[model samples]
Target: MSLVKKSLAKTASVVPSSTETHAPTAAIDVAQANAPVTENEQKEYPFFVAAIESDLAQLKTFTDIADKASYKSEALKRNDYLGYIKRYRLSGQNHHNTVLAWVFIWLVDLKRWDDVLELLPLMVEQKQPLPTVFNTKHWPAFVIDQLYDDANYYLSQSEQAGLFTISFVLHRLITTVKNQDWTGLEVVGGKLYAMAAKVDASLHNYGFAAAFAEQALAINEGAGVKGLLKDLQKLLKQSEPEQAVDAD
Candidate 1:
């Protein structure tokens, strides 16, 4: 067997082992669900397994190709990487799960947070299984699994749904900070804080954003959230005058 094959077999064993150790019942349940297939989902099952199994070789090619491209400007490089992936997809079947997993790892390694947010759902859905350490499978599995929690947490707390949450929040945060958008900052900040608190009052991200909000408000002194917050407050004031005033 090639190194890749040996590593995958090793990974398959370790992933289930860790799960069994940590959550025995859950692991058993998943193992049963993940049992060797019958005929159903037959068309896609092999594809899924093949894609998962191909991680190391695929990732090696991806890195070798991406490194030779460009890494100058973040935006330019982001666009280049995205374009390269798109071209790769066009060249063959749209094995989006594989692409999603690789692209997320690439973007995260690049510190291209904007790109990561944009591609996060695809990453989440790919649901790559964890691999052994220093192996191609390891990072994707960790990212997909951890983000499953992050996403579920985001949804249970969100008033809005789908395509809007991460994209909007990501853009809003970056924009607000970049332009010194005090009102925009407050508005997005408040919504995120409230939503996060609803999910887990103890969530560290929530605490950080809340503290930052307090600082932003202090910077303005008496202005209050001036941009989107102001508009939201106005809407709320008109809609629920009593509640709005009380909140203020």
Candidate 2:
């Protein structure tokens, strides 16, 4: 068997059975019904699984930057399949839908941040299991790691423009994770706050940057934000006189 198939088998064991009751949620529009799976859905499910396997195999071979960029085009082609899975979830069908889980992961991989946010609540509510290749069992941790990595990449570019986008998405992600109380791997949540601080600092939002840095330190003393928080505080102090002069 290919590595992807092996990983899929491993992931299958962790997925909750269809008979399991979903965790209650009041925020997302997904229903809480026990609707039976349609015959058409049952018939079509295997094709989606096959497609995912094919895509995963192709994804494994993409090791270069140019090859990686193709993920956006590939991901777009899967949109129709994603829609079908979304409809299944909305109908209150809670089961081990690998198609739904993989498509969500692909959206994140493609940096389709807004689309990922739209689907995040329902994914958490259903307690979806990530593909084993990611090495983390919790989706929240995976998400934070992805955002932090992206933030660092943009920071390395020394361009403030990319940081602005990361800041916007990270803020919404942090809010969604907190509001939903989606607990994940240890210290991961603090990383999100620290990245938020870094991104905001790059964008020159000193006050907001300081606040996020402080929050990161509060969450994890070893979050490495102590120096960042100190710098932001100094920046804040420096800005105060300018604000006062402007007020005059």
Candidate 3:
């Protein structure tokens, strides 16, 4: 087998192993052993395994071509890389998962903002939960596997539901920070920001919107988000009683 194949087999084993070691801290984490690893758990293993295997192969091909081209930028100029970029860029539904984020990052590094914007959702969705990522030091299988998968549904429900989702996710984020597991927070907070933005926008809850937007900005201020600070200001002013009356 090739180096990539061997490396992945190694990663697969190590991920499960870490989960085994950290099974005691949280009850949710304890149950992670049965949380359906995949290969998330890959939406919980045969699927995870297959998806990961396929992704690794594609990644290897991308890198090999990138290296030979030298400019790195030069490779992206080619049809093969360009095609991959276009194929992965999800249009409206904008979501990101871990696997695609890695590729999307490279595109960003190349300063392809327009391309990145189109692909942003996928890159972002890649962080969402796309292909499960387990056992990486940054994201323990336990954390990824245990995060409430129903968070989106919660956000889609009433404000109360959205609040609960935020609390639930925020608590976990704090716990990881306490434990100094910065890596565990990967894409985890995005769930919070996305949920918060939806809830606030629906209610015109400027206070919460500003807060969540701040948090997201601290992490990253992509074009869609970089405006949160100023946007919130404008939104509040626009909603003021005087401004509303002025429309008449």
Question: Which candidate has the highest TM-score of all?
Answer: 2
Clashing pairs in 1: 183-226, 183-227
Lowest summed lDDT across 10 adjacent residues in model 3 is found at 14-23
Give TM-scores for every candidate, taking all chains together and pairing residue i with residue i.
0.27, 0.77, 0.31
- Using TM-score as the measure, name the better of candidate 1 and candidate 2: 2
- Model 1, 35-124: lDDT tens digits are 554232223324334543454354445455555233323322322335433323333323434434544565555546566655544443
* Top candidate by lDDT: 2
lDDT: worst 10-residue window of model 1: 13-22
TM-score of candidate 1 relative to the true fold: 0.27
**lDDT, candidate 2, 66-90, per-residue tens:** 6765864554453355546654765
| Count of clashing pairs, candidate 1 | 2
Q: Give me the runs in candidate 2 sitting further than 4 Å from their true place.
A: 1-37, 61-65, 68-72, 180-184, 244-248
Pairs in steric clash, model 2: none
| Candidate 3 global lDDT | 0.44
| Overall local distance difference test of candidate 2 | 0.73
